[model samples]
Target: MIQDMGLELIRIMGPFDANLLGRLLLTLVLSGLVGLERSGHERASGFRPHILVGIGACLVTMAGAYGFAELSSERDALRVASYVVSGIGFMGAGAILRHGTTVRGLTTAATLWGCAGIGITVAVGLGWLAIAGTLLFLFTLTVLEWFERRLNFGGPISRLRIHLRDDSRSVGKALDALVRLGVPVKRATVLPGAGTSALLDVELARTLSAEQAPLLARQLLTLKKYVVQVETAITPLDEPTTMDESDEVQKDDTIVPLNLKDATLLRDLNDPDEAVPGSQTERSR
Candidate 1:
């Protein structure tokens, strides 16, 4: 009787005997592989979430294929599979984000959607196709990225935000510095800020190289009187080290005289009625 019971247990644990469990495990391995790639990139939806999505999609597909075997003539096996496809969109939508003119997380969303497809494929017993699809997915993420970088293909553009004194002279000086450094300005906007400062938003052109980006940032810092802060998406080569506190105070005192001179010149230009000093001397002669 014990020998017969062992034989029965073997039958219960056979591949065909437990097909649902096999499908679920296949889904986990395939999705987990894709998730590992995403996790390496530090995405929002990493390993665990991708695994769950894969397993859930696999379960749904398996249930539709087997659970309704009795009603196979009356019901369509693909009904539940169709629902999984549509329902995965809601999850994909959560991964996308939009900031100003830039949109992020698109690739992550597509990856999640692909994971669901892989799960469905595995559930239908097309294991070989699912594996091939996953290998292609990884190639797109890894190899394609390397190719893009090598060919100088522009992906996401970088943004630079500058806070500076609220003066037209300051704006002109800042623009001049960026232009001189060969940094192409795609779009520039000036927004009013608190106190006497203004915010400048600049989108850079694609031609800017990573090496040149930090140099441009350092050049902007030299305009200490006009530029209060410079923020960029690119990481700086070194910490933003500024001059000594005492030196900064001394520079501030020295800058006041030049500012007064500029203010006088601006006032003279605006008020045409004010006689120019050289012109008055010439009239007396």
Candidate 2:
């Protein structure tokens, strides 16, 4: 009869523990914010995945805290929390991406890891600490977004690959012309092409604004020694091959005046055997 009474008392109080209910509510709230940010940003691990991770992290944290609290002997909650850290790492790794020279999704993965830490903190009854962490994460993602744009510091950098005919003379002339123009050339690689074709890999400076590039490109077209091709920083092997493409591609807009002497000299260089015309009017349009 005494044993039955003890068991009934345990059952009655078991479902109403203040610490247990608090942990459940705290973890749910914290994880929800983390998941919300990911979903809003359109990540693959957004919505359901993040929510699950947050809840799971919270449970793990609760387990570590409660297990330690229940022990009569010495127990380290931190030891159990360390396992959560390692487990979160595996999830973070799945979010990173690599494409040629650019690596993306690092911030998103870091955010996921951060959510786990916050969840653990909440489970350990560090309510204030968890709230502060959530605010910091949102500030970094939202406020810093505008700050970066104002400085024009973030986003993908432009990469241009300039291709020319394989002839050494043609390439040399174009290089000389570019050098004369003071265009910041980052790198130039010679790539073998089919037949007598070849590619000149070019990296340019951001100082060359999109608006200003068209004017300089008009002069490049007037040069007779070589044709050009343009591409972004990463050029896929299967990309279509083309001639006379430049990083500064121009739409057929207003025409520029061509100096007759420059035009005659260019014509002579391209076709030395033929008689050159005096008027530059042929290329002016």
Candidate 3:
């Protein structure tokens, strides 16, 4: 049975050597194009992974179509292709990520799946479909983003850097504060900081005009336990991190709101039991 199966496979696959090689090369090109756009945007899994997925899927599809084609009339030759579709999900899931309740990389994950589809399409001799699918993927990644921005759908995206205690609770509170302010968090990360502190880096969308950043900063400082020191300054969205120390503190432009000493002083001056309430405190009832 084994010898006959080998013979059947050899006989069936013998004529498609040159065509198979051509399909692989075509699959490589189509998938590579999709990956190129993703890499240009600095996505998680870029060029090489995409090409690998596309080529791998193509090979699996080929095996499903030809490797089992001559085994028996009862064999389902396309079974492996179906598995490819379902299995691609694991790879796609790796591309998806969660950043402070804002899920990112959904598009990247979808692209990986699309690349697999491109591979399978080419493997099955559906070259036109593969090419068309690739073009559509590229167009969605490139053009759809521009339309999203132009529509004011996300307003303006701004980056905020908060250096605070390394405790996870503090980080959560800071993010919660941003959310309460009504700007949706587009992305967030906790980076290592000096000593016991961590940097809470966040990207916010639909932020108010740049002029209001100080008021916003002063406001965040109210989270005394969560935020150690706070200052708010607004520069063009493209220039979020470019401010120098001198510029960040200049009272004319930035608002270096209540530092720890000031918070303490207010508590000292006001009735000690009052808890210094207009740079306000949220008391649990």
**TM-score winner among the candidates?**
3
Per-model lDDT: 0.70, 0.62, 0.72
Better of 1 and 3 by TM-score: 3
Residues 1-285 of candidate 2 have per-residue lDDT tens digits of 999998999865554568767766776777677778877877887666765776677777666655545554655668778998899899899998763333557878888888888777877778899889988988887888657544544332334455566667766665555555555554455677667877666554333444334534544555545755544332222343233543444444443332212333344345533434654654553
- lDDT tens digits, residue span 117-146, model 3: 899999999999889999888888889877
lDDT of 1 at 193: 67
Error of 2 at 6 (Å): 10
- Stretches off by above 4 angstroms in model 3 are 1-16, 73-78, 165-170, 180-182, 191-198, 210-212, 223-285
The better candidate by TM-score, 2 or 3, is: 3
What are the per-residue Cα lDDT tens digits for candidate 1 across 1-285? 999998999766533647767878888998998899999987879888889999999888877776665556554547887899899999999998764444667888888999999999998889999999999999998999778544545545555777787766677677666655556565667777669788777776553344444444555656766777776664223233232212321112222211221222232222224456689755775
Order of candidates by lDDT, top first? 3, 1, 2
Give the local distance difference test score of model 3: 0.72
| Candidate 2 vs. true structure, TM-score | 0.54
Worst 10 residues of 2 by lDDT: 255-264
The per-prediction CA RMSD against the true structure, in angstroms, equals 13.2, 13.7, 8.1
